[model samples]
Target: MPDSAALVKQLMFTFDDLVELDPMSLGVLIRSCDTDMLVYALKGSKAPIRDMFIGQMSERAGAILRDSIETMGPVLARDVEQAKNNILQKAKNLAEAGAIVIQRGDNANSQVIY
Candidate 1:
């Protein structure tokens, strides 16, 4: 396999010094994204990876993000295709759809919330 794991590791990030992930998560993403390297990177990360890679999409998404950023925005550039562009963004990215099952304060409940 030529150490696909190495490629996967090189593409990961760390949040709070923890590395956590399940196998199918990355595979599903890789399939759905049509082998798009950027999507794969973001989906495969131990942390919620993002556009912080500096136009960090697969060569594919990067090209797209770069064009849009240069043409129409500076602010938009930050999030044009960004996942965890900043710490807050990282937090947001880290939190997945099923990550939370309940809300506190407004409504007390049990949840993973990532």
Candidate 2:
């Protein structure tokens, strides 16, 4: 796995960066991401992105995710942030491994090659 510093330097999309993507592109990335990464990202992410991820999953998976988030008690801000970072890192790794493609947003000028 790449170091976090190098990962950040590479500047792939973090969860926060999802907001910049069009719905179709964002949905593709969400569906391609690892399940655990989706869980982690959902826990820390805001409503729109969270909804997008849940929407991409099956009914059962979506229900389970919703329940998990509901029953999950308070988590530290830093931990939540770390979870989001982990998702970003995992996506980067997957892209690097040629498991998936991480494309630029429709509005972006340049693509980040993993």
Give the number of the best model, judged by lDDT: 2
lDDT of 1 by residue, 1-114 (tens): 669975554244333212122333332332333223333334434333334332233587556644443454233333423432333233334345543121222234432333
Point out the worst 10-residue segment of candidate 1 by lDDT. Answer: 14-23
lDDT of 2 at 97: 78
Question: What TM-score would each prediction reach against the true structure?
Answer: 0.25, 0.68
Candidate 1 local accuracy as lDDT?
A: 0.35
Query: Which ranges in model 1 have alpha carbons more than 4 Å from their true place?
Result: 1-52, 73-114
Residues 1-114 of candidate 2: C-alpha lDDT, one tens digit per residue = 569877666564566665554456455566666666566667878888788777766799889888888778877788777778776766667667766556664535656545
